[model samples]
Target: MSKFKYIVVALLLSACTSDDTDTLIENSNTLTNYLQDRSVENGAVIACAGNTEDDTVSVEIFFYPEEDATNYRLYETSSTDVDSNDFLNYNRIFLNDAPVFNGYLRKFTGEFTTERWFIVSFEKDNEIKLSNPIRLKNESQPTLFANAISINQQLSQMPLFNWNVNSEMNNAIFFQVLSTINNDLISGTYTYENQFQYYDTSNVILNITNGTPPDLVLGDDYKMTIMDVSVDNWINEIFVSQFTVE
Candidate 1:
């Protein structure tokens, strides 16, 4: 990543929503070739730029359209039944409802699988960037074991969230998980190493205490809505699940 110069998005437009801070000028002379190309090698998924060797990463970054009604920054888990989670980072990644980056290529290496999710943390209020998710196909992917499976039924408040972390993930800095209750969304970013089963005892608890948006209810049917996220052809995996409360 240090080898390439980032291309900052200098587009200017006008705000339309509460989350929108600056106007987006898409066709304007901001910066082009920000990102391009994608591939998988051994077990490492790579994102490429301008077809260069140095500019590559296992995860990818995306930006919201300059003008969108919904707050892209709001972390809303896409409907579980929809089979994909696109809005997982719109809110958690950016405070202003957009993205800003200047560079020719961003390269990364580390453990990657179908169950992994990655996100980039910038300065506060600066936009956040997430890698398109990937859920490795069991057949194509090596064995991924969950040390502890969590299932909470009956009366209770929000339960603690925990899962296995792949030990092979290399160069990973962070992990991002997004869950939903009906249409309500709850997102949490954690240290990448926490994904392994070794830390299941200290699982994460990302709740509505911070006041992100709509809260949960007594009973609701929810699902993780798994899908593979990618930029151009570079694809990362995300896993969804079916869970309920009673």
Candidate 2:
């Protein structure tokens, strides 16, 4: 072969190899095989906050670790939900270190004005434990539930949370979250009452929940958030109140 032709062939071969390498790298990072390899289940508690001023959404994940799980990985997808057919498209985002209260918690912030979904998983003894799909949607508008909310901080240690729920929300599930001022989830659960007492279990429904009960710090501020969630995981209304521990 002529010297010029030999050089041209060498350049083409290099280009082909580079393209192949890029494809492999992208495939390796995808969640194509995660769903098939993991045992999917529920129990991850997700709280979403939408900033109307910034047109963004913030999601927080707080859950209890499976026995012997050393770490947890969080996956994200723009899909509305991660059904069996859509699970393979999820992309892992956060890899948490050590399965402690603080370690099992993660916060995700994005410029999302629409809804998104996520899945969290952990591995122990080669067995992967995956959480049921959690959804995050931006709700920038106020609702009736927001207008009818009130908190009684006179009994500071365990503030009484009260809200008015009309007949329309009779079947809706209510969620209460207690978090530190810094946004760390302390305790959260699904409840069925219009009035809930912090750190108390009177109104709790299915204690299959997340976060540790707060060890209130004197003079520190904490937040209590109440959400009315629809069956399909859409947050219909949300109200947040901050109170100082006496």
Candidate 3:
């Protein structure tokens, strides 16, 4: 009788131990796979000013899941303060097409100024997975001038270019002049300092007397592009315009 009682007690203890072990395993799995692996990409801040009418901005995101997630949702916010819920707005949401991971693209466009902030968020399984933010600024536009030109009396010297001087340029604007023969390849290159609007009493001009000339072959077409300096050196909202060298 004593042996039987001891055996029964041992069996009960073993069952309790097994139950504890199973509980631990379940809790471990929940902690390990609690959230989805989500990330943000190509986040940028765009600025616009002046008489410009339309512009577009795009952003991309990539999400990875530990297991098969059937549904996902995306959210956007516009505040720098993370603690505040005032910026919450549903911009986009979609379901997963693939099982494990994939990429998502988002785009937003409108007239906005320095007063606004843009934020993007991603949610999976009702949990916030990722967030990204960008800040906007109103930067001054730059002015352009045509410096020097050479003219041939036999050729038509209708060399025209357009530019705007920046009143509030954070740094000097860099310029590149491109020219092509027969419209196949660029024949010449020129670089100049970006001029300030204060220096221009009138419109900025490019002329042959300045040592720059619009001498072209008879009956040949030419094209020119006066592009903005690299975005790395300048702030946002720096406007640039181009003209043809007739």
Candidate 4:
């Protein structure tokens, strides 16, 4: 009777242990499936110009879980290996306050001025699964002017030159304007403007009003180049299409 009782107790303990192991295995499978189904991609582009800052840009991480993910932790790295087991060294973002969802968006805000690349991974059940890597390139430089050209009509009151501002550029410090006649006549200095577009006819130029410089020499061809100058003097050059003055 005593032997039978001991045997029964051993079997009960064994059964309970087996049940616990099975529960762990099921949880692992659920987490794995969730990670496999999720995806990550590049987020929004944020730009900061000069010394000012804006928080409009956000870095987003998207995810969907199959089951109720408790104590979910996010890890990030710059490395490419998606199978690495150890990611504790990488930066982490906790999802404790995040709402349950078939999909969730994690947004990060701060200075992203310099170019950077990062990889993100999810963690649960002592398992680490990596998402697709994201690349964030910083576009803080002033944009190049486009389609600059010299208007025909040399004897005109003023040399007519036009250009398009770089679409990516914002908050320009000034514009550096350069003019050349017959591709040999170089201007002395640059011009400044807070605006994206500019036109030179008469009042802007001394010769246009006084008639001393004559705006331009009649019948002579001219080429003009315009550049957007930043505080750092990062100049984006735009050369005009050549045209002859009438």
Among all windows of ten consecutive residues in candidate 2, which has the lowest summed lDDT?
A: 4-13
The CA lDDT at 227 in model 3 is 29
The C-alpha TM-scores of every prediction are: 0.32, 0.57, 0.27, 0.30
Off by over 4 Å in 4: 1-145, 150-157, 168-183, 194-215
Task: Report the candidate with higher lDDT, 1 versus 2.
Answer: 2
**Candidate 3, 1-246: lDDT as tens digits:** 121111111101122255545654554322112221322221111111121223322222222222333333333334333422222221332322322111111223334332233333334344443322333332223223333222222224434344443443433233323345332323222223443121122333321112333345545545443323322222223232322333
Q: How big is the positional error of residue 57 in model 4, measured in Å on the Cα after superposition?
A: 28
Model 4: per-residue Cα lDDT at residue 180 = 48
Candidate 4 local lDDT, 1-246, one digit each (tens): 121111111101122255545654554433222333333211111111111122313333323332333333444433434432222223453433232111222323334444333334444444443432233322543233355453434435354444455543532323223334433433422333322112342223111111222255566665554444332223333344555555
Q: How do the candidates rank by lDDT, highest first?
A: 2, 4, 3, 1
Local error of candidate 4 at residue 211 (angstroms)? 13
Task: For candidate 2, write residues 1-246 as lDDT tens digits.
Answer: 121011111101122255545654666544444544344433333322233333335343434464466456777675564452244457777544332234433434444546567666666776565555555555433232353557676776767778766444422567676778766778766676667877778667744345456567878888777766544344556677787776
Steric clash count of candidate 2: 0
For each candidate, C-alpha RMSD in Å?
A: 15.9, 14.6, 21.6, 24.0
- Candidate 1 on 92-128: residue-level lDDT in tens? 2222322222221123333222333332222222332
Tell me the deviation in Å of residue 102 in model 1. 25
The lDDT, on a scale of 0 to 1, for candidate 3 is 0.30
The best candidate by lDDT is 2
Off by over 4 Å in 1: 1-149, 152-155, 171-174, 177-184, 193-215, 225-237
- 226, model 3: CA deviation in Å? 6.8
